[model samples]
Target: MYKAKIFVNYKPSVLDPKATVIQQTLTRLGQTNVDSVMVGKYFELVLQGNEAAVNEQVAKLCSEMLANVNMETYRYTLEEVEA
Candidate 1:
């Protein structure tokens, strides 16, 4: 069995509104060092097959559907699991 952990995040240039909310909350709590916060997505996929094939298929799926190429970037790590 093969498992994939995928992480998707916004690009550096993107402005995340969640950052403002977090900063405001921190300031209310007397913490000023807080700078920014960005939201991201994490996905785990499992496939029953060879490692190489699963990796390729998952990568393709991420590129084609899971991640938005224009403003988001994604990366994945694969591991073998014994059942």
Candidate 2:
């Protein structure tokens, strides 16, 4: 078995309105030390396959479904796991 930890986030050049709002809210709540806030998605998938196959599937899913290639970026880590 393989475990995939995927992370998806907006590109730096893309403006994240939600993150901006959270940052503003934090400032209002006196969390002045927070310079910025970024919103992202994390997914943990347990897949049954060899490392090479799992890696290819993970990359395809990230690009085709989990993230928008034009605006978001994605990365993942894979590890062997006991079923």
Candidate 3:
């Protein structure tokens, strides 16, 4: 088995309105130390496949469907796991 930890985030060039709102809210609540906030997606996936195969498939999915190449960037860490 394989375990995949994936993170999807908006490109730096893309404006994150949700994160901007969160940052503003935090500032209003007196958490002024926070410089900024960016929202993203996180996922833990368990797959029944070899490391090489799982890695390839995960990369394919990330580029093809999991993230928007133009505006979002995605990265994943794959590791062996017990079945």
**Per-residue lDDT of 1-67 in model 3, one digit per residue for the tens?**
9989999999999999999999999999999999979899998889987788899999998999889
- TM-scores for the candidates: 0.84, 0.96, 0.95
Prediction-by-prediction clash tally? 0, 0, 0
Candidate 1 lDDT over residue span 1-83, tens digit each: 98899999888887767766877888999997777666889999988888888988998999899999788899999999886
Off by over 4 Å in 2: none
The lDDT of each candidate is: 0.87, 0.96, 0.93
Model 1 segments more than 4 A misplaced? none
lDDT of 1: 0.87
Compute the lDDT of residue 37 as modeled in candidate 1: 67
Estimate the lDDT of model 3.
Answer: 0.93
By lDDT, the better pick of 1 and 2 is 2
After superposition, the stretches of candidate 3 with alpha carbons farther than 4 Å from their true spots are: none
Quote the lDDT for 23 in model 1.
79
RMSD (Å) of each candidate, 1 decimal: 1.6, 0.6, 0.8
